[model samples]
Target: MFGRIGRTSVKHPWLTILAWVVAAFALVALAPALKSTTDQADFLPSHYESVQVGKVQERAFPEQDQPASIAVFWRDDNGPLTDGDKADVAKVTESLDKAGFNLVKKIETSPEAVSPNGKIALASVVASVKDPYDEKLLESVKELRKKAAPLLEGTSLKMGLTGSAADALDSQESSGDTDAMIMMATLVLIIVLLGVIFRSPLIALLPVLIIGVVFMVANGLIATAAEVFGLEADASVSAILIVVLFGVGTDYILFLLFRYREALREGQAPKQAMSDAVANVGETIASAAGAVIVAFLALLLSSLGMLRAMGPALAISVAVTLIAALTLVPAIFSLLGEKAFWPSKAWRKQPKHTLGKRIGDLTARRPGVVAGVSGGVLAVLAAGVLTFHPTFDAGSSLPDDLESVVAMEKLQSGFPAGQTDPTWVVLEKTSDGKLEQAEVEAFEKKLAASGFGEVSPGVIGAGGDVAQFAVLLKEKPSSDAAMELVSGKLRDAAHDAAPEGSRALVGGLTAVFADIQTAVNRDYSLVFPIAGLAIMVILGLLLRSVVAPWYLMLAVGLGFGAALGSTVWLFQGLQGKDGLLFTLPVIVYLFVVAIGTDYNILMVARLREEVRRGQNSADAVRHSITHSASTIGAAAIILAGTFGVLLLAKNSMLQQMGFAVAFGILLTAFVMALLLVPAVTKLIGPRAWWPGIKSDTARPAEPGPLLTEAPAGDRASV
Candidate 1:
């Protein structure tokens, strides 16, 4: 099947190229732009208590004056606010409201807004929209800041905004041009690495040009899918998509190129070698991409809409890359023929006694020692997983020097840490009428006594059916402690202490984080196993052996643990961070489990090919490593380099993700695929193929040889 596709592509190279170009252009011009939402609630299902509370708020408090942001006012002299400063604060608030900023509803300040210690004054910046993270609202906050500087010119009061909207804006500004940085870094890394490896500028730059087109097509398709299906992507999707497409696309390109070069070295005609290249490596690439796609698709089981949306989106990208790899790559290379590696005559011959060959010989010579050492290293690193801690504080990922973060710190000096965002415990009538005063009082009292925090008096809506009580937690509202309080004791107290006629629901950012934590935990249990099982099935089908899939999966699983544990050790243990991003485990799992399998698949498939040629188990393992290791190493370095560019991002989440995925790729490529997998397979012997044996002694006829092992006439068809 693969041979047919390759032959057709090579025969009709121009037509194939034209088809891809036209399709990419059409999609780019016609597709709707992908939209993203920063609202945490949007990622949750409507069934979650936090989401339910949001719905109730919309119904019960339609005209609520919910502040989109808060302006913290302090004396420039760093002293208590005097009477003059408080009056100036009110004036500044009024002027900012009247500055004609879009989406600005009203900015209010009162005498009572002064802190008890007289050190600070507060102003609420309410928006016309409910979502504080709305882009327009963030724009309004930005404009308001500009307008305030002029208003406060003559007054002693200085003000800075700190709230959801302002924080989002600051985060956006702090990450300025980061996507450009990542793209540039990735391209430069790939170009440099490829140039160094192939010593051909054309070879280095061609994949970039090809993958660039593939990138646009993948993005257009993703956007069209999102538009048609009404999917909301998270803001981080664009950056992640860039890496995945380029990284994986380059990987597939290298796989084919290596085989093509090998066939050429055997002296086959250009087109024939290209065709044989596709036939030889096609199954391996397809199986590897299939494993990744299925693994990504497994995110459909995730409770969080973010992961659910991400799954299909990433799967679509890999699918496009796979198609391009099997078609466009071969078509273009077939036309270029030997010219693809122009200015470098090295492709005409093979290098001798290289590191890959040395390592391969070592592994085949002493499989047991190599397996024990590699496996032991992974196990020791896996121990760090026990210390893994998850944090939900999005603000912490932003630069501390940002205006919103600095303002938040200042606000905490005169108020509680949770003053910027308080948890809400609502009491509502189960039937229709307004909540009884006694019931509201009882719920508030119970909540305050629940050990979560101090609860404010109930604020009843105009409908009178619901009352909201703000809980100012002792910890920051986004802290792990706050989420724990909301998810555990606070929730139990609210549900259990509600009056007989009324019901209670806990809602707020902390509540949302708690719910997200629950959803992530659920996804870990559900999505990881499903993705792992699905990949194992792919491995089993590809190897035609159930026993081989089990050990391969175990190796990949161990690689994942090692990657995550190493990340946790660097961030939480060495760097003294409170915890990793709440979604770190998910990101690590997807990349490590899926991508890690790619290297393993390539190695095992090569091993199988050598075995089919009637080579002994040890020689097969040695030859597999010797021939496939350089390809794996080069691809791994490029992919890992692309991800490692994320370390350049100021956002800690991106940095952590970058390090984890990059390091994991290196570990999987070097330790697991190159050393451990080959060593273990060697130890397993012919039983590795168990029920589908194809050894020299077991098979009725000798299987086809690899291009390197085949006779000159047979090389064209191999």
Candidate 2:
């Protein structure tokens, strides 16, 4: 099948190239803009308590105001706020009102809630608009910032905008930096590593150039698909897609190039070598990509809308990458011919027994010892799985230097921890009946008596049909305790305390994050099994052996467990954290299990190739490992290193994700690929390829197949 594909691509390289160009242009021109949402509530289903509460509030207290941003004010010298300072704050608010920002509702200032030290005061800016994340609101924030700057120029008071808007702006700026850093680092590392491996500038530049085209094409298509399907992607998805496309795209390119080099050394012309390279490595690349795509598509089962949206978007990206690997990469190479490796005569000679050969020999000599030792290391790390916990604190995901974080800390000292963002309860008449003032007062008294820390005076509806109360908790809103309290006792109290004709709703960050947790938990059960099953099917088809797929999947699963276990041990047991970020498990599972299969497929495919070439099972395992190890190891190291740079992000979620993925890739490459796979193949012997003639001793009628045409001396060198 792959051979036929190679022939068609090589036979009409120009046609293939032209098709890619047309597709790229059409997709880019037709694709709709990809949209992202930071609102946690946006990702949760309407059935969740938080969403339910939001619905209730929308219907009951439609006139309620939501603060779009907050302005935190303090004296520059850290002294008491004088009368002049209070007037200055008022003047700033007046100036913002005069500026006529379209989204600005009314700016409210309070001098009474100044800090005990008298160094700070607070002003809240509410938006008339419904969607706080709307770009217009961001524009309003920008205008407000500009207007407030000069209003305080001559005053001793210094003010900082510290709220959702500020946090959003900061997040956007930091994400831009992270994207630039990841791209630059990935490019430099890939070029340097590829240059070292191939020792040819053209060979090094080949992947960059080819994958660059693939990225543009893949992104354009992904955007089109996302738009057509109404998919929601995060800003981070673009950066991630770049890494995955280049990293995995480069891996497939290297796989083909390695074989192309081997074929060339066997005296095949550049054109025939290119065809043979694609034919030989094509199934492996396809299987690897199929696994990744299935895993990403599994995200559709996620209860969180964001994951569901992201799943198909990433799946589309990988699918395009796989197509390019099979088509675009080979076409470009076919055009470049022997000049692709120009300036490097090293391909004419083979290196001495490499590190991969030594490791393969070790595994072949004592499969039991290698398996036992490597498996034991992973098992020990897996012990940490018991300590793993999930954190709901979104604040922890943001940089501590953010003004919202700083002001939040300050607010906690003087006020209740949840004062800045309080949980709201709206009670409305359900039967088109008027809500009595006495009933509303009674409900507020019940809430205040429920030990909810503090309850603001109730604001009655203009028509006397509804009332809203702000409930402050003693704990930080995103804390586990807070979520638990809100999801449990507080919700129960609100329901039980409401009058017969009225309904009560609880809505806030804590409630929303708690609901998100439930959504993610549901996703785990739905996505994990489906993704695992889909990948197993791919493995089964690629290997043409049912039993092999089962064990191969088991190996990948163990790798996932071991990776999560190690993270749990480090973050929770050693560092004394309550839990990891809630989304870490899914991220780890998707990357580790999906990409782990790439290494497994490469090794298994090479093993089958060696076996087909008439080597016995044990010798085939050793030969395959020895031959494919360097390529797999180099690719894994580069991919893992690229993911490791995510730790450089200021966000904790990115930090944990970076460490988990990077470590998982290393574990997959070194422990599983290098050790477990070979040992198992040795133990299974020829039976590992049941239902296939991989174990049969049959030689081709011809002198040698194109893929195995490397000289005996060169084989020994590999």
Candidate 3:
């Protein structure tokens, strides 16, 4: 099947090339702009309490003023705020209100609650719009910042905006930096690694060029898909797309290059070798990509809209990359010919048995020893899984040096921890009659007495119809204890304490994050099993052995456990973090299980190829390792290193994700792929290919003669 594909592609290389070019241009031109939402509430399912609360608030309190940004002010000289300072703050507030910036509702300056040390004051600026994530809101915040600069030019007060919109802008800027670093690192790693492995600038440059084109096309297509489907991807999707396209694309390229070099060593012409390479590696690349795509697509099962959207987008990307690998890659290589290796003559001859061969021989001779040792090392690491915890605090993921974070900490010390951003208990009239002042007062008193630290009532509906109370909890809003208290006790209290004709709804960041936890939990059960089953089916088809798929999956499972366990050890045990981020497990599971399987497939495919060529089962394991090791090892290192750049991100989530994935790739490539798999293959012997027992018959050897000195006909083939 692959041979046929290789022949056709080599014969019609221009057609293949032209097709890719045309498709790329069309996709780039026609696709809609990709859209992302920074609103955490949007990520949760409508069924979650947070989402329900949000819906209720939107419907009931349609005209409610939402603070788009807060102006945090502190005495630059570390002195107490005197009457002069208070007057200055008032003037600044009046100036902002008079300026009448777009989207600005009003700026309120209050001296009611000054910091205990008397060094700082707060001014809350509410926007007319409800959605804080609105672009107009961000623009207004920026304008406010610029306007405030000169207003306080000679004052001792230092002021900055610190609220949802400001923080979102900061996060977006940081993410852009993170993306740049990740891309630069990945590009350098791919170039250097491919250059070293192939010793050809053209070969090294080809993937960058091809995948670059793929990225532009893929992103454009994803934008169009998102627009058509009305899907909302996370802000980080672009960064992730870069990594996936390059990482997966490079893997496929290496697979083909390895087989191409092998075909060349057998004396095939450049064009024939290119065809043969595609034919041989195409199935493995496709199957590997199928597993990755299925795993990412499984994210559609996630209750969180963000994950559901990401699943399809990433799946689309890998699918495009897979198509490019089989078509565009081969077409380009066919054109390049021997010139692809021009600078490096290493392709003309085969190196003698080296380091990989010795390792393979060791495993073949003592399979049990190798298996036990490798399994034990992973087991020891897996022990750390017991300590794993999940953190829902998005603030914790940000660097502590940010002004909002610092101000938040200071606010925590001086007042109720939730005061910085209180949950709103929105009371809606269930009946047609207007809500009376008596009912509003009674509800406010009940809420205040319900163990809530602070309850501030805003103006009820005109003529005192419906009322709203901003309730502050005693604990940090995003803390687990706080979320539990709010989601369970506080919610119950609010509903029970509401007036007979009015109902209460709790809506805030903490509530949203807690609901996201519920969504993720639901997804774990659905996405994991579905994705695992899908990959198993792919493996079954590719290997033509049900039994092999089971064991292969088990190996990947162990790799997942080991990766999670190692993260737990590093972050929980050593770093003393409260817990892993809530989303880490799923991220780790997808990358480790899916990408890990890529290495496993490459090794196993080679093992099967060796067995088919008439080597004994043990000899096949050894031969596969010797023949396939360098290619797999080089690819793994580059992929792992590319992921490692995530650690450089200022955000903790990215750092954790970067390290976990990088570690998993190292484990999968070096330990699982190189050691555990070969050792286990040696133990399983012929049963590894059970039901397909061509293992019982010694098959034909390679067409080339075995000896160093070849016969005339053998020389022609070799």
Best by lDDT: 1
lDDT value, candidate 3, whole model:
0.79
For model 2, how does the per-residue alpha-carbon lDDT over 1-718 read when each residue is reduced to its tens digit? 7787887888899999999888877767776777777687878888776787777667666877878777888787767789988988888877777677878888888767576677778788888876666778887887777788888888898777755666566556554577777888888878988888778788788788777777777777777777777777765688778778877887777777787787788899877878887776777788888899999988887888888877887787788888888888778888888787788777778766577678878888888898889888887887777677898776667777776677677666566777666888778778787888889899999999999778988888666777888888999888889989888899899989999988887888788987888888878888898888998888778767777777777788788888999888766777676678887887788677777678888887777667766777667767777777777777888888888998888776677888898999899988997788778877787778788754546554224342322112123232
Ranking by lDDT: 1, 3, 2
Q: Scored by CA lDDT, what does every candidate get? A: 0.84, 0.78, 0.79
Which residue pairs clash within candidate 3? 2-279
lDDT score of model 1? 0.84
Clashes of each: 0, 1, 1
Number of the top candidate by TM-score?
1
Model 3 off-target regions past 4 Å?
76-80, 97-105, 113-119, 128-154, 172-176, 429-436, 462-466, 499-502, 694-697, 700-718
Q: Where is the poorest 10-residue window by lDDT in model 1?
A: 709-718
Between candidates 2 and 3, the lDDT winner:
3
Stronger candidate by TM-score (2 vs 3): 3
Error of 3 at 76 (Å): 4.4
List residue ranges in candidate 2 displaced over 4 A.
61-63, 74-85, 96-103, 111-120, 128-158, 173-176, 397-399, 460-466, 573-578, 693-718
